[model samples]
Target: MGAGFSRRAFLQAALPASSALAFFSTSFRRDSLISAATSTKPQKVIVVGAGLAGLIAAFELMQSGHDVTLLEARMRPGGRIHTMRDQFSDGLYAEAGAYDFTDAYVLLCQRCFLPSR
Candidate 1:
């Protein structure tokens, strides 16, 4: 759930850059919500997958001022971040197929990791 939320937020943050500006310029002007004085509006975007790369891209696009939606094929998010904690004892954590993260991953984690419940 947390990963899903984070993914959504990332997409929302990067909405603009990922969309077609020409499309947004023409389509959004039709909305009564925007006034003639308002020349431009945010673009609508759909992002496939919810992995670190996808989510990061979505976030970057959204941060540029667009609307974003994220879609995932799996039942849960976290992608390769999946764990098998339940299969291990307390103080033990295991990655089914993934190992440690990289420097870029560390940067992303610092910038976008979801807040704790």
Candidate 2:
């Protein structure tokens, strides 16, 4: 335990490291691991809601070669992450929900959307 150490940070770093070690060890082959991670037969997936969690889940499923159908009851996506525009007299806008995010959320967004180097 250190000054800034937390369970979240430890798990974040350790999970990937453990998976990498398991796949890259002499017992496993790189090609075999890659093929195993990908689907040989694509399957249809239905994801309820287009919120942040559901959107990310659908994206991941599609990336893994699955056909994903995202359903949202709202008129638009981003379930609770909504902003009201042009509803005020002075043309001011307001956020109805999810206006702010934490450092961990920002990091997760970067990891999800940013291209790997």
Candidate 3:
């Protein structure tokens, strides 16, 4: 055997490629995989509050074949996104909360910094 050659080493390297080949050639169609997910039975889901997080959760649950009802105590859908037009001049309004969405905010969300238990 050569200085850098062994049967164990060759088998370890070839296993992953062969496994991938078998996976791709399976009977399941790759392109229609999304459409193949069977629609789940309709379930009743009540979401508390109409905040951004609550709205997102409700939307996702509805898409997965669940009947979602949003319950908001406030008069508006946005929880803390308050705008007062009376205090400002004519044709003017003030945003008391909720900053503008940006690309950096998305990049920040993509990163996971918290340690898992």
Candidate 4:
């Protein structure tokens, strides 16, 4: 009861009650602990679109021990790389949609933005 009371004596007095409380805490289920401790395969993931954003997400997930698959809407990948020749001038070429990928976007382009090409 004094300020100089020994912690060992206090613990000796309190240990049984604390153990009893732990034994009766049904909220802590045994199965949950078992599942948490068990080793399992990595999560499987699928990316709906092979677009820039989707591809980036897939890359990060795969790096973290998850399996990933990229699904593209169109027959070909490149979400917006629409290149076409001019209507009148056959020699001139143009990009109808999507920004061109640069060196800064190489990894993203290779992993997510561009398809297998």
Which candidate tops lDDT? 2
What is the per-residue lDDT of model 1 for residues 66-99, given as tens digits with 9 covering 90 to 100? 6889899998766777878898889999777456
Q: What is the lDDT of candidate 4?
A: 0.64
Per-residue accuracy of model 4 over 6-56 as CA lDDT, tens digit each: 888888988999789757854566445335434456777788776655665
Would you list the C-alpha lDDT of every candidate in the order shown?
A: 0.64, 0.72, 0.66, 0.64
Q: For this target, which candidate reaches the highest TM-score against the unseen true structure?
A: 2
Query: Candidate 3's residue-wise lDDT over 74-115, tens digit each?
Result: 989877778889998999998876766433234334443433
Q: Ten-residue segment with the worst summed lDDT in candidate 1? A: 29-38
Q: Could you list the CA RMSD of all candidates, in the order they appear? A: 13.8, 12.4, 19.3, 22.5
| Model 4, position 56: C-alpha lDDT score | 58
lDDT computed for candidate 3: 0.66
With a 3 Å backbone cut-off (N, CA, C), the pairs that clash in candidate 4 are none
* Candidates by TM-score, descending order: 2, 3, 1, 4
| Range of the 10 consecutive residues with the lowest summed lDDT in candidate 2 | 99-108
